[model samples]
Target chain A: MKGRLLPLYVVALYAFLHLPLLILCAFSFNSSRFTVWEGFSLVWYRMMWNDGALAEATWNSLLIAAVSTVLSTIVGTLCAYGLWKKNSKLLSGSLYLSLVTPEIITGIALLATFQWAFRYLQIQLGMHTVILAHVAFSIAYVVLVVMARLRTADPALEEAALDLGATEWQAFRLVTLPMLKPGIAAAALLAFTVSFDDYVITSLVAGVDSETLPMMLYAMARRGANPVVSAISTVIFVGLGMLIVASERLQKA
Target chain B: MKRLRALFLLPAWAFTLLLFLGPMLIIVAYSFQSKGIYGGVVEPWTLENYTRLFDPLYGVILLRSFVMAGAATAGCIVLAFPLALYIARSGTRKSLLLNLVMLPFWTSFLVRTYAWMFLLRDTGLLNSALLALGLIAEPLPLLYNDWAVIVGLIYGYLPFAVLPLYSNLERLDKSLFEAAADLGAKPWEAILHVILPLTAPGMRAAGVLVFIPCLGAYLTPDLLGGGKSMMIGNLVQNQFTSARDWPFGSALSLALMAIVMLLLWALLRRDGEELL
Candidate 1:
């Protein structure tokens, strides 16, 4: 009786977890303005496409996600590699601290720092600050993911490559690099998704001219139920869904 | 060779020092200074910002945030444990179930929160369906309350609770359950005496994992609670934005950080310095 009931409970919980998002996705295609469906249409999607601010936000989000992902992935992978080579309790502890820090605090801290520094430097918060902040927070995630991959990797293979007269760079490039490829790819995907989805931090640091997709989506969401918001959400939902699926496959590969 | 490996650590360390640690240190400094008349911090380092935290208004907000986060963490543990057990006990579908749990988490948090807003709004889907079914004359106040905020927090952090608990359950020795059974322990007794005690660490970890995020949650309360259920996250965001009180905001940030560090220190002491 217990065994039979447990699975049923699991199914119920999964339904609770997934049904709202699925319903939202379904309503994104509704023809009418209200929740009561009036048959399916692409009207809202059309509106999302035509919105100039949303288009600009999308461009900004993509640019930041792209640049920050590359930078964080490189830096984090190297840091993970370095840690693997020589363990530093202080550095690892700091990474964990950053990971566990609340997004609000991090956002404000960065905001305070920028406002203070920019006063002296005569600069302004914009896409540059957002990108910098994204990289800073994202590096911890990348390091954690890549470090998990490194722990599973055998050190003997690298030593063997060195014993066979290959240089340190050559061994890392030819052997370790190929092995780390999947982990690196997974880290990049994680970083991109995080940077793109970020609202609190991005909102705090973003200038008037640097709105991202999430910052825009949030404003629309706050105003109430707009099908245009749903339409954009569906786009992001499907887009990130595909990316996560790919990342999972890469990790398994 | 040693120097080459050190080179690999340079970029990350520099980034951390310049961006992460430096900014945090600046907040510490700002918290002691006075808020400028306009929007920035000024000289004359003082503890006025910290003393202002004693105000009843900020105290209520802090207490509310604490209670809401605690309630949400408890809800997540209750909901997550059964699901985690089922996933751990599953044979062929364990990985699939695990992936399913993580899928929603991987999606945009704003989209997920918006989904809840779409459901719980006055004229939203839930009310629409209930009204169509002759449930009530007026739409129930489903949105913009403490309850709605708690639901959102649980939903957002449920995955964080599940993964750790499932991992712990997976590593348990099955023979222990059989041993309990043979020793005259009933099913509930076996779970209470055997499984619960053994998996306490995992549950503790999950509690911290869920609690910390819920404590600092901004989007859920802001979007779902509609400013009715103000949290610490909202309080901090408000100071930086409309309040335009940088010193006060910095002080609030430090207070929040201190609470977090207290929790982390407790967890680390129990787990012996390894963070998952």
Candidate 2:
């Protein structure tokens, strides 16, 4: 805590965190198929752009993330609002459980549930299943983010609106909903990030026709370290990094 | 009006019940059934799945997963403590540092793991650099092992460890440090005796956050450990996939949930509800 060594250690720690990402980005431009330092080229980026399955996967990921984020944000905001009005220990407790539970278990449980239900429903794991799974897991995060904002908000505004001869719905819609927009936006951004980045759960519930971006990335990674994977990753890393920073700014605002 | 208020919770509750809780219940029931001759589940409602977990094959795996997850949790603490403290004490740079930490948390974890894979592979960046620098005669066998898995877990979960500790440190009484200094304690002594004791709860929270995920980690071990260093997660995955034994998979998952839930119960009892 007291030496020049501390500053150096902090720098090294940041290096450990950021250096791999920088390297991946840099190598993404390398022309060689292997890791050797070849001349700079956009070949991998072009290949990633041209890959048909990869394009479809990206579309699927976006669609899933968009739908799930909207669904979870609406549901979670309402749930958090209700809890704020009158706390339910059981409800909030389960939300915490969803957050803490590991992805593998959740993935398997949802998979099991889908398979069991399919016996009667006559459907297979597909985009709908993955979207539902995303909503199920992501509702907790949205609720937490919104609940944090709700706790800081003054409840008296809604009460004042109600006392002024407004209906309860009008009071909430006019007073509370306006105050919650930024939090809802932040939570929606977070939900989208979580849904898009999810691999394990998405993989389990996605049928062959519904592969998401992370599933495709996983397949490419498993095949070996290719420059195409690096290119795609660099794009995602930059995109999501901006999204998160924007969410933080929104939360602060 | 009260009933109308409850309607706000209806969608969330129905979604949770029909999807999350309902699936969990299905797995719990399946755990008590036996493996069907073909694949799924066939029930006389036997406890063989849980009993079979006592086999030494799984015992070794469960033990190894515990040790590796523990090692990763400890590593995250060691690496994150100073960083968290540094961030808590900094002024203008504090928010920037916090953003940097959360950046990886929001991005694709699979991409970051792939970054590590790109570095650690035999024909990868680390080996390529070392060979170029003449640091070694041959490439070190860095990937596809227990150490790789441990390192991956630590890297992936380090941000989770840092944020909790930082939040705790941010709330600490700065006067305590000053008092310790006024009482003639050196900086090291103040940190050891004063700061360390106060941050213990935060460390526990960080431990729970990191350890639970690390214990049930599938992708990290699967990609880094490479079929060799199998964790309990991988074993459970195998049962459902390649092994085609859903009942055993359910039992394994239940066993995992039990361990996680027990840990959560202890933490909640000790720390109230804020640990999440």
Candidate 3:
């Protein structure tokens, strides 16, 4: 009885989880504007494709995610290695602070920081400011993920390379870098996803011209239900789902 | 070699210090200052912003945020516990079950929230299906309310609650249960004394994970509650955006942080170190 009931419960839970997404995808193909069933159609998808603002937002999101991923991955991997070499309580504690801090708090704080800097620098709150904010919060995640990976790595591997007449840099480059590749990749993916999905912080720090996908989606959703929004959501859902699956495969490899 | 490694750490440290810590410190300073006539901060310090937090309007918003967040957390716990237990007990399908739980989380949060809006709106799928079934004469007022906000919150954070509880339960010692059985304790008593105490840490972690974000959630209430309900997060955003009251916003942000810090401190005190 328990065994039979368990699978039923699991199925029910998963149904609850995925039903909304599935419904959204289904409605995007419905010809009618309302939620009632209509004949199949691709009109909403075409409308979404034609949306210039959304196209711009997607481009901005991709660019920001890409730049921030590269920056955070490099800085974070190095920092993780440093922390591994010498565990500093203060450094680790500060990393924890970034992880635990609410998005709104981080958003406002970064917004204020940018505004303060812009006063003297004469720079605007555009893609650059958004990138900087993305890099700031994203580094913590990369550091944590890489640090966890580093803990599992053998310190002797690097020491062995060192004793084999290789220079310190060569030992790190050849041995430690290869070992940390999986971790670095995972961190990059995490940073990318986070940067891509972020709304609160991006909305606060982003200039009017630098809106990201989430920002656009929020704006559209606030206005009202549009079938085009559903179409865009389906694209995002499929795209992100593929990315996650690919990353999971990479981690396993 | 040690010096070289430390050198590698400098960039990250400098970035975080200049950007993360420095901005947070700026917020702290801004919180103490007065709001300028135009928008930004002014020189002379005052606790006026914090005092304004206690006013009835803001107080009601704050109280409503807590109530909604608390309700969502409670709902997640109740729903997640059984699901997590089932996943943990499933011998062969555990990883698959866990993955299913997490799959939705990987999607964009705003997208997910929007999906919920589509479901709960008056002409939404839920209402349509119910109407077709003759469950009601008219569409029920599902969206643009506190309950709708709670549903969105719970939907977003339920996985956070589940994953932790599943992990803790997965690691539970079956031998302990066997021992309890041999001692002739009732099943309920065994669960109460053995299982519950062991899973307390995960429960606490789940509570923290769910509650903190829920307390600061803005998108759910804004989209699902149809602006009828306002939370602390919405209030803070308004201060920064529409209201253009930076000092007041900073003060509110600091207040939220203080509450989070207090919760963390309490958890640290209870757990005596590592928090998940």
Candidate 4:
């Protein structure tokens, strides 16, 4: 029973999990507009290449993600630093507070404040605001990941630098930063990916003109079921798959 | 020197307060206010928002979301436990396969969700396959309903449940199982007396990790519900976009958070950690 049931269970679980995604991949290549498998074609790929809205949205998404990643990384690294040096109760509690809060709560709270409190603050509710929201949430996640790395990190290396007459800034730049590179890289990748994928937070914060790919995709999805969504899904899967593979290799190295 | 440390932390602290806590404080305050005629929070305290939310129409939807979220969490635990055990048994190969499992998580959640409609809709992938197999005369009603939501929740959260259980199971003491067997305990007893107790914390962690998020999920239901009903997340969404009632939305959100806290307290009463 053990031997017979084991692979049966694993295969069954993963099949049930991924069967939908596989359909999405297969249907993306289907030539006919209908979802049923038609003669295969690369027309969707060609269309994606020429689509101006998608082209512009792609650039906007990349810019938002990059900006959020860098900003979140710096703030996160310092927050991780303060939390590390003291491990004080207040810092630790607040850190865990944001980490555990539901994304919806955070999203709505920020939305109400942005559209209400800061409504007259004169900041345009566009790319700038979306990036700010992304960075806020992304910083929490990045801090958590980097803090875990910092926990097992030997501080002696930094101390050694200080012992050799390196200033605090010099010690961090040369010694701590190098050792923290893998952790920082992982944090950046995570921050970027999440910022890229986010819909709820961005939707509430993004201006009418500053549409991320996800918001656009969400509109297409909710308005009606379209096979074009499948094509978009396939492209994202391939793109993110490459990123994941690349990151995993980098992390291992 | 301490002030210097504070300087490094200033940016995050300020943003989290302004963006995170400040808005949350607004939500908390709004929850107690009256809804304006024009669909915003009125500048006065009233229990109208909270009372309005509990009306039967909204209550039914809340009940539906709870039932669905509970079913999803239970299903995920059942599916993930054995899978985690098998992966734990695989030793070195476990990490690589596990990495494969987490690969989709790096992709956009929107795409993964839409992927479900591709497989679950009538005349979609699974139905077509079933018809081809000559097993069913018709396609299954798999999409835009409870089952679709369940599938999405499990698919989205399964990796979370699996990774925790695998680590907990891997850390189990083999000697205890050996001793149980030596005492003539059957396989079932070995699992119950030795394995289950040892790894119960994994279940607790897995359950909380999946349940709390599932409770607030909007997209899965909105995309898959097909107007079957509204959920807590959907209610909040509608409050902003359609209802235009921010005060009521805030009230509903606060109640949802309270429900989450109550559930956490209830779950912690059965601390799986102490099971060992």
Candidate 5:
């Protein structure tokens, strides 16, 4: 009886976890906007497709995520290599601050800095500022992932490459870079997702023209139940879900 | 060789120093300054912003945030401990179970929170299903309250609690339990004496992870609590956005950071080597 009850408990917990998401997905198909179902239809999905502001927000989000991911992955990979070679405890410890600091605090700090700088440089708060904020936080994750990968990697492989008449740069390019590919990929994916999904920081730093998908979703949700939110959410859910699955497979490979 | 390595580190360290550390310093400075009559900051620093935090209204908000966060952390611990233990003990299907726990974790946070709004709203599926089953006479008021906010917080943070606990539990030596049994200790006694003490670090880490985020949570309370329940995060957000009080916001942000830093310092003191 105890053994059977254990599985039942686990099953109930999983049900609790997944039921809300499944319900949201299911209701997105309801023709009626209310929770009470009318007939199944794609009207909400079509409405999301026709939302011009949302489309712009989605584009901005993709742009910021893409830029921040690339920049952070490169800088962070180098930083990881530097930390591994240098073993700088202070530098490594400081990275944890970004991870632990609350998002609201981080957002305001960045906003204050940007406003301070813009006073001198005359630059406006827009996509550039948003990308900068994303990269600032994202580098922490990338460094962490890469550093973990570096720890298990055999340092002697690079030494061997150096002994074989390869330049230091060549050795890294030929040996370390190849080995770190999975970590870099994982880091890039993580940075992208984080930048893409961020709301609080983005909302605070984003100007009128630089709205992202999360910002749009917040505004819509704040107004009331819009079936378009359900439609857009389903799309994001499926897309990111696939990305995570693919990344997991890649890590295993 | 050392110089070359330093060159590689320059870009990242410089970026962090200029952007991350630089902004944080500005926030500290802002917290000291006086709020301008027309938004933003003014010269001639004062402690007024920090002092303003002691006002009864703000005091209540801070207290409420801590209570909510504490409750959520406790709830997560209760829900996550059993599940973590089950997965740790399970054979062959461990990865699958872990993945199941993580799938929703990786989904968009805003999207998941919005899903809860749909589920707990008065006319939501939960109420309708119960009504259809003749289990209720009318729709229940499930959303726009403290319970809704707590549910959302737990749902969002459960995986964070689970992951740390699972990692710690999975690493425990099975022989320890067997040894306790050999000594004629009961199962509950073994759990209390051996397992709980051993897993305390994981529990602490989980609590910190869930509690810190819950304390700073804005979206959950704003959306689920229908803007009625004001947490510290919402207060800071309002000070900057709608309240147009930058110095006050900076002070609040600093206060929030101080609490987080204190917790982190405690964590570091307890588990000095593992956090990094």
Candidate 6:
């Protein structure tokens, strides 16, 4: 990064990463009769709004993401807390396995388990199953991110709180929990975003009825690269960017 | 008190044990069981699924998956190490760059991937741009082949590699380079002798993170690899969906898990040694 090349290096990397996405956003509003851009217009965005099926899928995705984010955060915090106390090499390795294990393996394995177990429980797949799958991955991620944060937090602060007559839960709520807020917020947003965007695992585990945004987008893209899909992607991008900004603002507040 | 300390980890242990390890064990067992004609596990057990898993056609696929994953991992490391070094050198400004790297994620994975498909195809951006520049008389064949799949894979997994290496390089004992220089070692030699060895664990971590997932990657390869080239992931998917060979799919799933576990073990062992 010396002389003339430094800015060029940055430009090249940025272009490599974002050029396609910029093109997609540009075409989303394109007034053209085709996929390629003719001129900017909001017709496709209007079309996206009017599509009832797309609207329903959007609702499903939001609900799934919210429920999954909350569930995963709770479970992940508990799981990370549990692991933090133990601190055994053996347990650490096992925790890492959950993160490293491929989604397909977990998806199919859980499908088989659900098929066998839930038949008696009478649970046919739908939003619940999709949430469950999303939670599964989210919890692993939550555990990982929160654990990293927890490691940097001082154990003595909790001990001092306890020395001042705080109970374990009191120490946790008064000190540890407040300190870990940013990590939790980060983990929640990240988990929600990932779950909202997932396609393959959701496709495998979900029943016939649960068509998340990604599932719809995948079908649309597969059949043909429909122009409306660009509009949908634009909506997702702007919404996620807002959510991310809101999360950061929350952390600062 | 020690036992009480153990109690804290119960949730993590239980989560990993039940969801992670338990499902893995189930995959192993399910793979061995006979496929019931009605699309579930049969009463009888057999190695029929595992045997078919090793059939020449599938074997080629398994091999190709290794090659693709290896290529992707290499691609990630090459770009990641240099990029991470530069960013870490840039210090506080690095976070901005890191966030920008993650901006692709504001869009859906499907959308990001589809954008690549649109750009790399015959009449896509690179070809059109190149043709406009008269850099080439004909459009470059850039999409729907091994190279495109590799590009897509590297694109998806780059941040994973970069993050680990950045921190790893950033935390390096700066004095080590000074010591190497004092010992008359050239800058390259100093890096090779000190920095590379120190960052070996991070490199291994990045490799495992990138390679293992790349091996089982379903979307990038399927979308970009085209029907012509596929990995074990697509095969497993087919067995479950199109092929309707649940038993075979189960076996392949178990095989995939095994490969992941093995790599994880190797990585952790190396990481442990490196740390010590």
What digit string (tens of lDDT, one per residue) describes model 6 on residues A1-253? 1435655776787787888788878878889745555787998888889999988888888899999999888878766766676557776666666677777777787777667657678878888888877887778778777887888888898889979998887777788888888888888987888889888888887887789899998888665556787788877877777767665554444
DockQ for all candidate structures vs. native: 0.84, 0.77, 0.72, 0.64, 0.72, 0.51
Q: Which stretches of candidate 6 lie over 4 Å from their true place?
A: A1-7, A88-92, A245-253, B1-18, B105-107, B127-141, B173-199, B273-276
Off by over 4 Å in 3: A1-4, B182-189, B272-276
Pairs of residues clashing in candidate 1: none
lDDT by residue for model 1 (B133-153), tens: 998899999999999999999
TM-score of 4: 0.93
How much lDDT does candidate 2 score?
Answer: 0.91
Q: How much is the lDDT of residue A213 in candidate 3?
A: 94
Instruction: State the lDDT of candidate 5 residue by residue for A119-201, as single tens digits.
Output: 99887899999999998899989998898889988989888988889987888788898988998898888889889999989
lDDT tens readout by residue for model 3, A4-53: 77668777878989999998999899999988877999999888888888
- lDDT ranking from best candidate downward: 1, 2, 5, 3, 4, 6
For each candidate, what is the lDDT? 0.91, 0.91, 0.87, 0.80, 0.88, 0.79
Q: Can you tell me which runs of candidate 4 are displaced by over 4 Å?
A: A249-253, B130-140, B261-276
Among residues 3 or more apart in sequence or in different chains, the pairs in candidate 6 whose N, CA or C atoms overlap within 3 Å are: A82-B8, A82-B9
Worst 10 residues of 4 chain B by lDDT: B267-276
Which wins on TM-score, candidate 1 or candidate 4?
1
TM-score of each: 0.98, 0.98, 0.95, 0.93, 0.96, 0.89
| CAPRI grade of model 5 | medium
Candidate 1 residue-wise lDDT, A99-128, digit = tens = 989999999989888887788897799999
Candidate with more favorable, higher DockQ: 5 or 6: 5
Could you give candidate 2's per-residue lDDT for residues B1-276 as a string of tens digits? 477569999999988888878888999999999888889899799999999899997999999999999999999999999999999989899999988887877788998999999999988999999998999889899999999999999989999899989999998999999999999999999999999999988998889889999999999999999999999899888898899999999999999989999887877787765554
Candidate closest to the true structure, highest lDDT = 1
Recovered native contacts, candidate 1: 0.79
The true-versus-predicted C-alpha distance at residue A136 of model 2, in Å, is: 0.8
